[model samples]
Structure formats: structure tokens, C-alpha cells
Target chain A: MRRADRLDRLQSALDAGGYLRLKDAARLLGVSEMTVRRDIASCDGRFAYLGGYIAGGLESAGGMGYILDRERDAHIEMKRTACDSAATLLKPGETVFIDCGTTTTHLASRIPADSQITVVCYAMNIAEIVCKKPGLRVVMLGGLYHASSASFSSPESLEMLRGIGINTAFISAGGVHESLGISCSNFHEVEIKQTAIANAVTKALVVDSSKFDQVKPAFFAKLNSFDFLCCDDGIDPARAERLAAAGVRIMLP
Target chain B: MRRADRLDRLQSALDAGGYLRLKDAARLLGVSEMTVRRDIASCDGRFAYLGGYIAGGLESAGGMGYILDRERDAHIEMKRTACDSAATLLKPGETVFIDCGTTTTHLASRIPADSQITVVCYAMNIAEIVCKKPGLRVVMLGGLYHASSASFSSPESLEMLRGIGINTAFISAGGVHESLGISCSNFHEVEIKQTAIANAVTKALVVDSSKFDQVKPAFFAKLNSFDFLCCDDGIDPARAERLAAAGVRIMLP
Candidate 1:
């Protein structure tokens, strides 16, 4: 088949499935994965190639939001331990803000089913889990649903966060550099996270040890902004000392 | 155990599980289901027993919202048929509003994965399913999470709906009375439904045949407010004709 024919077939498959994996596109077009990649590259701005999946131009142009599933199992046990330690800080009757991320999902689950606390969240994954508990009241921030993160965000959601009195804010980050500050993948999340930090009595940064020293695209807060850090025992002693010296307490599980 | 002790154990279980079935509560207290029901009844304002499940006082006092799971299987095939018919009205590139309810979930699923349309929804269940499709841009109106309905609603969600341009509003209701108007179980859903109806170009009411003649607590719209009724073959012909004569077209699968 001609290269044009192959590209047409790939486009048809993407139109049908909404998205196609690179390998799937190759098989559907009867070409090698490398050929499929080259074909997609040839069509500038025609498709979004993110995390091995190809999506239509409309979605690509809108934004290729963060894909949470790929990062879900990256550091599973450590995330759970970190979140478990973080969950302990939540007291009954207080309102807490749970940030949007896979690590915070573990914290959402560790929350006592009958804690009688109100949970303020912006992510679907976190809200769905806690909403079922009859003892917990859930305040969900609404906005445009980003398929990339399975989370909601808008100016209205940020405004909603400001009005709520949060006792503690359990925040998640993609990177936690001492000097460069804390960051996450989506730019939409910055204002909401910053608002939570400003309004909450205690701002707790909950992340696995692997996030240390890494800097993601959207920076939200500085390291000193958090009251403390909840993480697993995988942190290097020197690194822990550095954070501690920087006036950020590291709470390990 | 004394009656007070049994009540204490029941409260503890309800706290741990958020909610418990009557049978499980009885087993945990080592008593008959009837005895457990009596105990819950004796507690009066302390416990909420709804649809065979026992929940804590906080949830019980905060309005026993409509439970979607219990109604999920009732007339399910007919609901699916009705929603399937409703889903056909959707066109690519048009923005639509999907109302919250178990029946609407079918419509959410049947939406073409590659139809480049924007879906505005207030329910977590509806948002979670449609957000994964790459061709769909989802605008989720967020607010307090209602566990009974697996939906979100707030004053701001209504405000958010007012600003968006909705081409079609696919509404679901608990009751569809001819003279009494359309109604739902929760009062919070009323304003959102009314706002969507007032703003949209086409208002379609999607309900199973059983909903006809039923009168729920919250009334949101009159029968003539809808442009069409998408329902199953089970709808009584006489009733369909009456609705048609009243200026509402009935679209069936």
C-alpha cells in the first residue's frame, strides 16, 4: 500500500476508536510500529501521540492531559504507606482537602469509613471512593472534566475551595525540588492547590519518596509552604536532612 | 447483650462500614433482623434505616437522597431501550447536557466514542464513563457528592449550567405526571434540571414507562416543557397519544 493509504487507514481506526495505541495502529495499517510513528510524524499537528496512544487532532489541540493509569502502579507500596501515614492526621468533624493524584487516592481509601469528616476534592477517583461512606460528607469541586487526569477544574472550583474552611490539605505533587518548588503535570491544578494551601490550617504534602528532586511542568508551591511531608522510608538520609534543614518536616512510615 | 449494647455494636459497624444491610447488622449483633430493625427504630433520630440499609445519624438527617442502586435493576431493559433511542438524537459537534440518573448512564455509554461532541454533566457516574473517550470534551459541574445517586449538585452547578450553551438537554426524572409536571427525588436536582431546560435548544425527557403517573417529591418542569419523550416500547399507546396530543412527541426504540 502507498504511504497515503496507510495513513488513511490509521486515521480511520483512530476515528473509530477515539484513540489507538501505536502498536495497534501499526497492526491495523499493516505496517511496522516505526512506520506508523513516521506516518504520524509526517502529519504535523494532525494527531496527538502521548504515552504510546494516538488521538485525534481536536483532543491533541485541546491538550493532552496527564494520564494517571500509567503512573498508578509505579511505586505502589510506597504510595500506600505514605498515604496511610497521612490519613492518620485527619480528625473527625474537620474538613480536609484531598488533591488530585494517584498517591492521594490511597489516602482517600485509608480514611476511616465513619470518620464523620467532610472531604473536599476535585478529582473523580478521590470523590467516588469517599462519597460512599455514610459517615463522610463530600464537597466536590466542579469544572471541565479532563480525560487525561479524570479530574475536574475551573475558576469556579477554585472559588469554591476558597470558601471552605479546610483543617488539613493533603496535597500531591509530581516533583518536590527544594529550591525549584513543588509541581504537578497539569497547569489547571495550580490555582486550586495554591488556594487549598492558603486556606487550610495545615498543608501536608503527600508523595512517594521517588518524587523528591524532580520538577514537573506546573509549579504550585514552595517546599516551605507545607507543614510537613508524608512519605515512605525510601528517602536517602542526606536528602531527608536537606529537607529538614530547609524547615520542612519529613514524616516517614 | 443488652438492647443498648446491641445498638452500640450496630453503631460501631455502621461507623466502620458507612452503611450496613439489615441482615448484616442483625448478624453482627447476633439477633434477628426484625429485632435489629426494632432496635434501629427505637433509636429514632439516631439511625437511618432506608431500603434495608442502616446508616449513621449524620447521613440520615441530611435527607435520604434517592438510591440509584436499588432502582437500577427495575425495568432495566426498558430503560436501556429508551436511552438507546434517546442516544440516536445526538449529533457530532453539538454540545449536550446529560442529566443524572441510572437510566442516563445507558445514554452516556451508547454515545459514539468518536463523535466529537461536548458533554456537560453533573453526575460522577456519568462523567467518569464519558471522560475516557478521546473524542468527547466533558464539562463536569461539580458540587457536594450525593452517594445515594452517585451524582453531584450545588448552587454553583446550576450557575455553571446557565453559562454553557447546550444544544440538547437529555433529562431523566423519577416521576412524569401529565398535569402535575416532571419531578425527581432530590430537591438539589430541581434547579439544575430547570436551568438546563431553560437554556437548551431541544429538551428531551428520557424515562422508563414505569415513571409515568408517579409523583416524586421535587417538581422541576411541566410535561409540555419537553420537546420529545424518548421511551421504550412498553409505554402505553393511550398514554403516548395523550402526551403527543399535549404537544410532546414520543420517540421510541
Candidate 2:
């Protein structure tokens, strides 16, 4: 497992459970207590060290940009392959909305250097990468900063998003299930994702195969909400057929 | 010098002179040609190395977010000391605007991890630093991304700035003169700086003594625009006194 993904999983566990015991976080993340300790340390002041438990400050302030930087390396190949598949759908000069997610980050990385596209983003990491491409205009939504997401979200951010016309949007979520549809762990993020989907002409849910059939709380979109679903081949065959039968276009690796 | 600051300085030199010979950049930055070679190499497609001179993509883009990253280390001690003096003016819980500049990045770094303050910024580098501190809310004004500045700016960005009421603003500039006042090379940046000064209750001009008495093209504010001037004591006594007499408070380190 990649360390960034582990750290993100650890943060999710902490946010869900309020506090995570070092042993449990390590066991769930398939790592040692030492790695979990290091993850917490790398988080700097975002996590409070309470003896055996790590307390993540997800709700202590507004819109903690919850992008776990280290998580980018976790499941690296799967993310890259999935992102590459997603890129096949993009055309030059199209205006795209990229949300803050470890997997979606790969799409930004995969974007052609010389592609003249307008990227609408909500985070620093993506902006840093996308802005370097010459002749591209990056519109970053501004508002309350969420340290964990590493993106901005608030009334203002949503208002800003409403002003842009998106041709295609690659949205991300923590999990998807037949019943729950699509969801992420953080409830604060759901509305922004929904808003992006609402404003986009064509919307695709870009998640890895591991997220298939799983369900997270704070549902954002229904299964039919998206025009396409982009994921790696790790998806179960049976579930893929079921989703495709339900009218969701699947972008396969 | 840090790699980011070095790249920024190289780009600034490239922007000013249009072309920079390899030997000149190495000699000017007081680094080895090998290090300069690596910077051009690491610009990661931003620069085209044509024989002996480095080519930057300046005119081919918009707003260029040119707050020099590596140049933060150019006058390392002096910039830090000037920023340290500026830090003394900050109070807990106040909303402060930190503009994109090498010297102001020092202020972001120097901010105590435990200090509870709201940071309003337009760039990712400072947002990444400021959002790490727990209990602080970061409001990043988002708009069109400028690759060189590594920040966002637009007419809409200025509109957004007009809405926010700032307690203090630590503004940066390329030059400061008794006559031309505070200015920067980019004409695109002047309006935003002017808006920040107008919205700020109290403002401080933060720059190294190197900028003293020099003048850049796009003047943003006058000597009396700021409540305090934060710089190294390397400033000329006569000039400082003349400015002090003109009602500009000086914060020296």
C-alpha cells in the first residue's frame, strides 16, 4: 500500500471514529505503528498526538483542505492507468473541473503539457501542476481552506463554481454502492461535488476499482447522476455489468 | 539557495532580459554552472534550453504567478530579518493578507505554529504553509493561475478582494523609491496590491533593504500608503529618516 493512501485511510478512520488508536490504524492500513506515527508526524499540527491515540482535527475549523499529499503514491499504477483512461475522453481546449482527490491528481499529472485546456480546481497541488503548462488558464475556486482536503470549500466557493461553464468534470468519491450510489467520508465535501456535477455538461465519476461496491457516508450523487464512470480493471465483472446495464458509461483501462 | 527560489530568480532574469546565457545566470546567482543546468532541467518543460541561453515561456501565458520561489534564498538573512520584524506586528485572531513574494513567504514560515490567525492569500505556496497550523482558517482568493507568480489573480480576484475586510496586509514589491513609491515589474499585479491596501485597516510594506531607493515600472502604493515599513536595518539612515518624517512607520530588524 502506498504511504499517502495509508495516511489518507488513517485520517478517514480518525475522522469517522473521532480518534484512532495507533495499533488499529496500523492494522487497518497494513502498516506498523511506526509508520502511523510517522504519518501523524508528517501531518504536522493537523493531528494531535494523544499517547496511544491520534486525533485528527477535521472539524476544529472550516474546510480543512483534506488532500493527503503522501496518499498520491499509494496504488500508484492503478491511479495512473485509470487516469490515463479518463484522459482519452478529454479534448483540447475543453474546460474541465478537477476535484481534490489522490486519484484525480493523476489525471492532472497525465494531462498533456501543451494541451490548451482551462482547469477549474480547488486545491494547491493540482494548481501547481496544471498552471505550469503554457497557454492554459487555471481557475481555482477560493473560499475556506480545508487542510485535509487541501482544497477550498464554502458558500463562496460554491458561488464561484456556479459562475463557470464546465464542459467535462472528473469528480471523485470515497466509495460507491448500488444502494448508497456515491459518497465520500466528509459531508462538507458532498455539496461541492454535487454542485460541480450539476454545472457540468458531462460528468464522470473517476475512482479506482477498489471503491466499487463499497459505501461511504455522506452521499453526494446517485448512480445515474454521472454520464460515465472511469476506473481501473480491478473492478468485479458482475458489478461492472450491473452498472453498465443501469446506463452508466464505464471507461475501462 | 533553495531550488524553488533559484528557479524563480532564473525565470525573473529570463523575463527581464528575454534570454539569459548559462554562464551569466550561474555567475549572477553565485552558483555553479552545473547547478544552473539542473535548474533549467528541473523547470520540467517550463524552460527551453537552447544551447547556452535559457528560454522562458513568459509571453505565451497569462499572469505568470512570478513570486520568485528560489530567490527567497537570494538575500537569505536579510529577507528573514525583515520578515521577522513584520511578524512582530501580527496579533492572534486577526485576518491578514499575505501576498505572493519570497519575503512574505518568510512571514508565512515564521508564523508560530500555535498562533490562531486567519490568513488570506492568493497563492498555493503560502497556503500550503499557513493551513498546516491548527486552529487557523485560510482564505485563498482563487482566480486565474499565474505560473511564474505561483498565485491566482484576475479582475474577479480584485472583485473578491473588495469584499473581504482585512485587518492587516503585508505587501511586497520589487522596488521602493521616495518618488515612484512601492512598485513591481508586472503591471498585472499593481491593481490587486492597490486593492489590498485599500481594504486593509493597517498595511505594512515588507521588502529587503535591497529594494530601497530603487524603482520599478508599475507603481502600486506611495510611501505614505502603508502604516509601517518592514525591512532590514541595512536601509540608509537618511532615506529611512526621510520616509519616517513623511509619516511612514518603520519596522527595522
Candidate 3:
């Protein structure tokens, strides 16, 4: 194979699998381990650690290689649709509360710059987006920095929340079951979500279809806590009906 | 001086000044620099490198020493008094949000453990207190950790916040003025405070009397964004009246 073809094959293997041992890549490329190492080095440190090479700074390849190379199973497009639908419910002048999660981030891009609304958030990404909105105001609650999610939360965030109220709050859940309500993988997140519900006049739950029926370790609040539950069209109708029966206005698009 | 007395003197010097150079300490103790280094080492790394030797790990002291010594500030009592009076507005069972800063941290201790409220925060010190409060639900936001204040902020935190709301937001401003509104020293903090206000129904500005009239780089909100303004009795009456005229209920103690 040509050197370029070998490199392409190596990239394809790494993109398909998030991580690869050196020997595996070598075997797949039908090249010696030394040749594989040399090829990786030619890429200028794009290959990292035991996790293998991740395509970095190659925006021209449609940003596909980087996303595919990551191990996450969630679909970004579904999350974006959910977020867009959630953003439509917020008025220009209202104060909107946002929680942290990859799905909720899609709402940030849709928030209109002309809106006079104030956005209060625990998610740093949303805060950055709201800050750029011309007339929109943004607030970030201070807390412990969780590196994986890149957000802050602690008892201090709750303390600062005393005496403040919100017009609306948007939340995400790791799992949504008729009996389990909204659940998350971390106990700390449950505390934050519960507090968010307690303070809002209206609550909306934004989650993708894939999250349904999946149970996480912690329960933050019951499904009844939310006035609106937004999910993609892929959600099972029976489950949607159950959510609607619980007084949740279900939105599917 | 006796050995104990010498140690006390060293500590006192550090307290009086923010730091004490090792060479300076040696001259004062009538010992060589090496001997001083050995003496400090005897305390088992209690001394920190402050370009030289600084007292370390003395919690009783109130100043910042190389060795993590707590030093007594001349304004300690005044700050404590201000913090005590400000903390009374917070009630139990309410979701509280705390902003990031040294003065706001003082309020953390006053939160009664018996209260059934959940606390969400970005301040690490405040989380420590919430952890001690039995049955108090503590939620921590995850994000990029800021070493200066030991807090976190990032896109992930914004995403996480989409799921929750706060009852009240307790925010501190770099500058609180009748004309300029509430401002912060950094853009990131401004965004965070704005998010807190939007998430809550009520907004409370907690500031020392000295913070009034100071202008910061970024504007978080107008003075009227808050429902209540809590400050020390030392605020100028004219300025307080101006704030009250701007629709902020002034609370002075």
C-alpha cells in the first residue's frame, strides 16, 4: 500500500474505535510496530497515550473524524433538536434557567440576541453563549469544578440561590421512567436538579429518546416535577402517553 | 529568647507582614541562613517557599504565609459582623445559590444544619460546609477550576444548569452604584451572576460597605435587578437612598 493509503487506513481504524493498542493498529495496517509508531509520529502528536491517535485540528474532513473517534454513544443531532424545541418556549424578556449537559447546550445557539431575557445557569457553556447575546444577561452559579462535564456545583450555589426566583427552568435527565421520575448517574447532580425544580414557577424537562428506560444511580426528582417534557419523535408512544397522563405536556418533533 | 518565644516571634512577624524572608528571619534570630532553613524544616514542611522561607500551616495566624498560615486581619471582626448580619436573611429549607468571593464565603458557616434545604454552589469552601450539614442536599456544578478562588466555570456547567432553578441568588458585586449598576472584575463572573439572577425569583446583592462606588470592568446587572440589597451599616446614607430610589430594598445592620 502507498504511505498515504496506510495512513488513511490507520486513521479509519482509530476513528471507528476510540482507543487502540499499538500492536492492534500495526496488525491492521499490515506494518511493523516500528513503522506504525513512525507513521503516528509523522502526524505531529495527534496520536496520544495508550488511547491511540485522535484526529485533531482537521476541520476540513467535515469534523466527522473527531466526533466519530470519541466513545460517546449519544447522538448530537437529536440533542440539538430537543434543545431547539425547548428554546422556542422561552420568551425574549423572560429569565430562563439552564442546567448542564451536552443536549442542553443546543439551546444556547438558538437564544436570540435581540431578546432582553436574562439567563441564569450552572452550565458554563450556556453562560458563554448567553453572554454574547446583545441584550441578554447571563449568570453563573459558583461551585466545585467537575472536569469531565466542565461545570460548577456545590452547597454554595444553593446558598446563593436563596431569595432568587425564576420564570422558567429547563432540565435534562439521564433516565426517564414512569415510576422513577428523572434520574442521573451522579448523586451530586440530583441535588442540583432538585434545587432547580424547587425554585422555578414553570419547569421543562429536555431529553432525547435514547435516554428513556435507562436507569442511572441517582434520582433527582419525580417526572411530575416538570410541566413540559420534550423528546424526539423516536420516543415510544406508550411512554409518551404515560408522561402525558402525569400532567406533562409532551412535545415530539 | 526561649525556643517557644522565638517561634511565637516568627509567627508574629509573619502576621504583621504578609511574609518573612528566610534571610531576614536568620538575621533576626542571630543564626545562619542554613540554620534557619533547618529550623523551619524541623516543623515538617510547615514553611512554604515565598521566594525564601515563610511560615507554613499556621491556622491560628490570619495572614497568608508561605506555609499556609492563617493571619489575623485588623478588619476581621468587622467582616465577621457584616457576614453575621447578612446571613440572617437566609432561611432553612430554601434552595440557596452563592456567588464566588471571600466575603460571601463567610455566610457559609451561618447556614444552620438543621434546615432541610438543598445547597448548590461553585465555591469549594462552601461545599465543605454543606458536606458537614447532615441531611442537607448538596449539589456541586462541574467545570474549569479556577485556582485563585477554588471555583469552577465552563460550558459543561451551563449545560448542567439547564435542568434546575434556584429560589434565590446571593451575589456580590465588584462595584454597586446608583448609575452604573452592579459590576464584576471579570467577564466570566458577570455571566455567572447574570445566570444566578435569571434562575431565581428573588435577587439579593451581598456587599461590604467599602465595595460601593467602585467600578469594575464588566457589568452583570442593573442595581434594580436585585430585590434586596444587604450591606454593612457603614454605607453612606446618600448612596443608600439612591439605591432605594432605584427600587432596591436596602437592608443595613
* Chain A TM-score, prediction 1: 0.73
State the weakest 10-residue window (summed lDDT) of model 3 chain A. A56-65
User: What does the lDDT come to for candidate 2?
Assistant: 0.73
lDDT of 2 at B149: 61
What ranges in model 2 sit over 4 Å off?
Answer: A1-74, B1-73
Summarize candidate 3's per-residue lDDT along B112-179 as a digit string, tens digits: 66787766666444453444444566666644444334355665565455445788778877677667
* Per-residue lDDT over B192-235 for candidate 2, one digit per residue giving the tens place of the 0 to 100 score: 88898899999999999999878888888898998999998888
- Give the poorly placed runs of model 3, Cα more than 4 Å off: A1-73, B1-253
Candidate 1 chain A: 10-residue stretch with minimal lDDT: A57-66
TM-score of each: 0.74, 0.73, 0.42
lDDT of 2 by residue, A1-253 (tens): 4876566445433321134557877886688999888987876865656557665532222233333323433564566667767888788999999987666766775567667989999865566457656667799988777666667776666777888899999998888887668888777788789888999999998888878778887898898888898988887888888889888888986
Candidate 2 displacement at residue A90 in angstroms: 2.2
Cα deviation of A228, candidate 1, in Å: 0.8
